[model samples]
Target chain A: MLRLSNLHKRFGQVVALGGLSLHIPAGCIFGLLGPNGAGKTTTISIAVGLLAPDSGEVDLGHGGTPERAEVRRRIGVAPQAIALYDDLTARENLDFFARLYGLSGPQRRERADALLARVGLSDRADHRVKGFSGGMKRRLNLAAALLHDPPIVLLDEPTAGVDPQSRNAILEMARSLRDEGRTVVYTTHYMEEAQRLCDRVAIIDRGRVLAEGTVEQLVGTLGGSSVVTIQTDEGDTRIETADPVGELGRRLAAPGVRGVRVERPDLEAVFLHLTGRSLRD
Target chain B: MNAVLAIAIKDIRLLLRDRMGFFFSFFFPLLIAVFFGVVFRGGGGGGGAGSGIPVAVVDLDNTAESAAFAAKLIAASELEVTTGLSPTEAEEAVRIGRLRGSIVLLPGFGEARRRPFWGEPMSIELAVDPSRAALASMLEGVVTRHAFEGLSEMFADPAKMRGQVRESMDQMRRDGSLPRAMRPAFEMFFNALDSMLQTVQEDSAGEPGEAADPAQAAARAGGWQPVRVSTRAVSARPSGLPTNSFALTFPQGVIWGMMGCALGFAITLVMERTRGTLLRLRIAPLSRMQILAGKAVGCFMVTASVAATLMVIARVVFQVQPTSVIMLAAAIACSSACFVGIMMLLAAVSRTEAAGNGLGWGVLLLMAMIGGGMVPLEFMPGFIRTLSVVSPIRWSLLALEGGVFRGFSMAQMAAPCGVLLGIGGMSFAVGARLFRPD
Candidate 1:
């Protein structure tokens, strides 16, 4: 479990984090959905102790901060950027990261080989990262984060530039991590990814959490309205109401209304409702 | 298994794969050392302990004094003396680049041995290629120094001095060409010199073996002639120094090698930060200090490795030997530490790969120029040498030279090593303070 309390951070004229706080639960995929420049990276940086907040605390259970080596060993982070040595082979990269976590020589070799196979990269294990394709690199990046097999895994845009197959593989890996009772804090721009993969989703905007709940709870509570469309000879009529079935029934009584269709809101609707439909970038 | 060493090993592996980094860190430095070694070692032939500057001595004057002077030249550890060469042969050796230079002791060299006030000015023909003006000048000084050393020996032997003085007086008295009007002033000076010689001769009269008979020494003293020797060039071989080119150039090469290591590793550090590797490293179970120490240790190990490799190669290929292996190791350790600190500072200051590459080389090249890496300390101008005290490269080179050839005792070794350690400690301290993992 990880807790960030009243984290306030600044970068000169920009406020990256403003009294932001979050409590990620154990043994589940927790999705942090935020637009660009919405304090996502800053929060991750603080959680990993790479950047210290001006005034706040990042508590990684057991009465210790992530700044402590013992506490930090329990956490793992795969950055949004493909963090790997270009000149080093995939296996070498894994071996190096594994060793940094104090894995012995034999253990590191075994773990690196196993992770390379798990990521579907055993065939190209000895190939340098410089020649790797974007999808392969993304997979290798995920493998690196899993090398030490820490309890808490934070994946930031893990499948950002990967193909569909690689994306599915990464999503499956995240699911497996959750199944193993490991907390997964995942950040991504894909709404469907959060809706389908995450047990609890937090939609953040402007460095603050706008909404946080399960997919059904958020969609139902923050859905606002459902649309009832009636197709007629002239055109199609659209209506927004809490009870789409009754609205569609009344609209269908009209002679010009040939057929009626009722639509229910989904997670995307709830996301758009909470954080306005505007491009952050 | 330590995290720091793991990161250090990873960094070394990454640097080794980079072509530019590999060239600078190893090959380029070796090229520099070998290039300068061969160039400065021009015309030195093989012989005489294989350690001194090679030269041929044509001893034309067969007198005891000339023989004594020739013996002195051979005794010099600096000049690898070769005997039994004609003046023409010695001259040809220098012309063909088979020898550094030659010293031709002409016919009048025995008479030219300077006695009290009057004797030929010890003229000898020195043969060397004119283009090698620095070596020419160095040879000239060497000859002058040894000539004086021989003169001191001549002065110390009372029998030789008394014999030469008595012979000069007799020669003066027998010259009928001298005008009778000026004979008394000349005779009075000669008488005074003779009186002084007699008194000195009497003082050592009781020491049996210490004194040589004046007649035997004076008989061997060759006939006097005017102050001149007939030859195209003038030379006198010098004494008491070693001339192994590797001894000098290898240390300089190691300096360049260390710079390469610093720049190479510095750029690697910047690359790690920019490429997001630092992010992963930061999130690992390691402190920021651990990461930096990892980089410093990597650079230090690589720098020391480069130095040791070059020295070993010099020992193997060039037959150059260090005066003290322990001292050389100390030099390697101190210089490596110094540059590792420089690497840290370079990494900390450079935010991007481009900046790291450009700025790292820029700083090192500039340091090399001012620190006597581009030129030796002996050849550097006064101001540059004065300013070089601040350059870590200068101290590193000094420490290495002390170990390799200067035969520096521990007390002599302490200054450069101390400065290097101090510089290393301070640089690492400040660099760590300024370093940002991301």
Candidate 2:
């Protein structure tokens, strides 16, 4: 579990994080969704002790606020960029990070090999990362983050430039981490990824969380609107209503109406309704 | 500790994998050293030991005194003298670069010695190639030295010197303006000179010949003879190994090699930061200071290794003598440490790899030029030589030369080594303060 309270960070004239707070429970896949420059990375950077907030407190399952080393030992962070030595082999990169976490000898080698295999890179384990594809490097980056097997995992847009297959694999990996009772904090611009993998999601904008809940609950709070369209003899008739079932039945009763269709709002519409802008805007 | 070693090992491995790094840090410097060493072998004053300057001698006097002086000039270790050449022939040899210079002894050289105090102004003409001025000056020095020695020997005979003294005193006494009080002192002086002349006459009584003139008498006694002016040109021949050229250039090559290491590793550090590896390390359990220390250690190790490799190559290819292995090692360590600190400072100064590389090489080349990388310090202008003390390369070269061929004792080595270490410490402190992992 991790808690960020009253985090206020500034970069000269810009406010990166303005009194943002979040509580992530254990064994949950928590998604922090925001557009570009939405304080997601700033928050994750503060959480991992990479950046100290101007004013904030970070608790990583400790009674009191922990030091940077303590927090680093408990959290595994997969940065947005492929932070690896291009000259080193995939296995070597893993082994290096494992050693940095105090793994040694046979145990270090074993962990590195296992992680390489887990990421489906066993065949290319000995090859330098410089020759790896974007997706393969992304997978190895994820594997490196988990080399220490920390209880709290932080992934910041891990699949930003990855292919669909690698993206799916990363999403599945996050799911598996939650299944193993490990707390997962993921940030991404893809709404579908959050819809599929996150048990609890937070939509942030301008350094503040606009909404936080499960998909259904957040969509429910958007008035649960549904769009109805009827194919009439004259033309197509459309209506937006909350009671889609009753409204569809009534619309079907109209004369010369060939068919009626109803569509419920999804997470995209809920996010737009709360932020008053598109996710990418 | 393990983490620190791991980081250092990783960095070294990366450097090894980089071909450009390998070339610049090791192969390139070796190539330069070997090339220059071969090209400038025994060429100038900086040329190595045992190689003398090539010169020609034209002895027109052809007297016994002239021949003896020529023999003495020929026996000098610094001059490779050629004899039995006419003046025109010796001048032609100098003109065609066959010799560094030529010396021509005039016909009256031996006659002038017979009356040195009132003789025709004897001139020992030196004709030298314009391009070999330093060698010409040195040749002039050799001729001048022989002339002075001949004069001293001619004046050494007590009989001839006493005769000159008595003649001068008699002239002074004949002048009535001579003070009455100075007469007693002059008398005492004449008495001492007469006594010395009597002793020489008694000693030379066994000789059969007698001459009224003091010059002839001294010449007959074989005590004082006519002065001889010897003229000889000197040139150099290539003697393999331990030449001054190699001695001066080898340390310069080592400094360039170290500079290459510094520039290469400094750019690598910038690359790591820009590529996010530095941030990743920061996110790891290692402290910020540990990460920097690891990188510094890695640079130091690589630099020292490059220096040692260059030194060994110099020893093998250029026949550079290793004066003291321990002192050499200490010099290498101190030099490497200084460059490692410079590398850190360079990394701290530039934000991008391109900028860092450009700035690093700019600083290094400037330092090299100022510190006698292209020219020996002894040949540099006075102001430039004075400014060379500010260049860290100068100190490194001093320490290395001291250890290699300068035969510096432990006490003599302390100043250079201390300056090198001081530079390293100061640069490291400033660079560490300015460095930012992000």
Candidate 3:
């Protein structure tokens, strides 16, 4: 579990994060959904001690003083960019990080081999990362972050440029990490991923968290309504109601109702309804 | 510590895999050494025969004496003489550096020599370049010796000698005092001289068919003829290690090669910073000092390896005989440390890979040029040689040369090694302060 309070960061005249705060519960996939330049990466960077907040403290759910070394040992960071040596093989990269994490000799080798197999990269473990595809590199990057098996994992857009298969695999990996009772902080622009994988989600924009709740609860805040449309001989009629099926039955009783459709408010519509802007913006 | 070793090991592995880096660090300098070694092999003045001092001769007399003198010059093996030039032409050649100096025999040289101890003294003119004044003086001595030998033979007749002795005795008696103890010595000398004159007259009477004058007999034998003069260097090299050019150049080549390592590593640090690897390491559990220390260790290993390889190649291919292996190793270690510190300073000063590379090569090449990496310090001007003391490369090369051939004592070796270590320590301290973690 990680807790960030009153985090303030600035780059020259631009305010990257201004009085931002959030609490991520343990053993859950917590999604920080935001548009580009939404302070998600900045917040994560502060939590990982890569960038220090101007006036804030990061508590790592520990009673003792939270030193940078102890916090780093307990957390793993998969940065936004593919931060790896292209000249080294995947196995060698893993082995190097493992050593940095204080793993030695036999333990380092076993962990690297197991991670290669877990990431489905056993066949290409010996090949340099320079020759790997975008999808394979993303997978290996994820495996490298989890190489030390830290209890807290921070993934900042791990599937930004990945293909659908790699994207699905990464989403599945995040779910599995949550199921294994580890704290997962996933930052992304994809609203559907938050809907499917995250147990709790926070929508952030311009260095502030706009809303935070469960999927149903956040959608309930959007008035708990469904959109119903009826196509008739004259034209199409649109209707907003709390119960789409009951409204459809009532609309069928009227004349010249050829077809009926019902749509529940998804997280995207909820986000648009709540913030008066599209999530992608 | 393990993390530091891991980083150093990884850096070395990556450097080795870079083929272009390897070539510049090792083979390129080796090729330079070989090319220069072959080109300058015979040019060294190793005090050997046939390495003649270049000069010209102008014979204006056109007489048998002058012709015989020219012939004598041609016969002397040491002199590489260019003949058949006029005085004006020889002087022009000397002025233009085509010759080191020139010898000119005046037109009346033969006639002047015939009258022994009189008539306008015939002088041979020596025209030389001012830069070669020392060489010109040596050549003058050789020509004077030839002239004296001819004079001694030309005045060999007993009658002429007796006349000159009596004339000298009469002058001394009139102008100065003969010691009281030496009056009998002069009387005995006059009696012995008359007896020698009678013996010479009897010998001439016995050999009536021969020339009456002993000088005429000597002239007939060609011994009293004008002595033909020529000049040549007895030995080319006056001092230092035997004239092998390779022995002189390999040390400089090794320095250049080691400098290549510094340039390569400096550029590597910049690349690591720009590529985000440095940020990743900073975020890791390792401390900042550990990362820098690892990189420094890697640079030292590579530089020392390059220096050792060059030495081995010099010994095998160029036949450079090293004087002390232990001293040479120490020199290499100290030089590597100096360059590694230089690499750190380069990295700290430049903000990007391109700037780092440009600054690294610019500074290194400047140091190399001033420090005698491309040309030996012996060929440089006084001020440039004096300014070379500021260059770390100069100290490194001097230390290496001392270890290889100068046969430096332990105390002598300490001076250069201490300076090198001092440079490394100072550069590292300043560079560390300037290093940016970003």
Per-candidate TM-score against the hidden true structure = 0.75, 0.75, 0.72
Which is superior by DockQ, 1 or 2?
1
Best model per DockQ: 1
lDDT (Cα) of model 2: 0.79
Model 1 scores a C-alpha lDDT of 0.79
DockQ (C-alpha based) per candidate is 0.69, 0.60, 0.49
Q: Write the per-residue lDDT of candidate 1 for residues A1-281, one digit (tens) a residue.
A: 88889889999988888888888889989998877778887888899888899999988886679778888888888899999998999988999899899999999999998888888999999999999989899999988988888899999989898899999999999999999999999997678898889999888766777788887889889987898888989988888898887787777677876777778887667767776674233
- Candidate 3, residues A1-281, lDDT tens digits: the string is 78888889999999998888888889999999888899999998888777878888788778322346766878887878887888899988888888788887898889889888877899999999999998898888888888778899989988899999989989999998898899999999898898898999888888888888887888778635888999999999999998787888888999998898788887888778767889877
* Superior candidate under DockQ, 2 versus 3: 2
**10 residues in a row with least lDDT, candidate 1 chain A:** A272-281
Q: Which regions of candidate 1 are displaced past 4 Å?
A: A245-263, A279-281, B43-243
Candidate 3: which stretches are off by over 4 Å? A63-67, A222-225, A245-258, A270-276, B44-243
Q: Clash number for model 2? A: 12
Task: Name the docking class for model 2.
Answer: medium
lDDT of 1 by residue, B1-438 (tens): 398999889988888888888998899989988987887674331121222555788888888877887888888766767788887877655643345678777776776674523444566767764434456656656666777652454544555666787788788889999999888988888788777756655665655664476433322232221223323432211122344666678888999899989888888888888888988888888877888889988898899999999999988998767777888899999999999889888988999989988888888888889887886543454567668889998888878876776555677678899999999889888888998776
2 or 3, which is superior by lDDT?
2
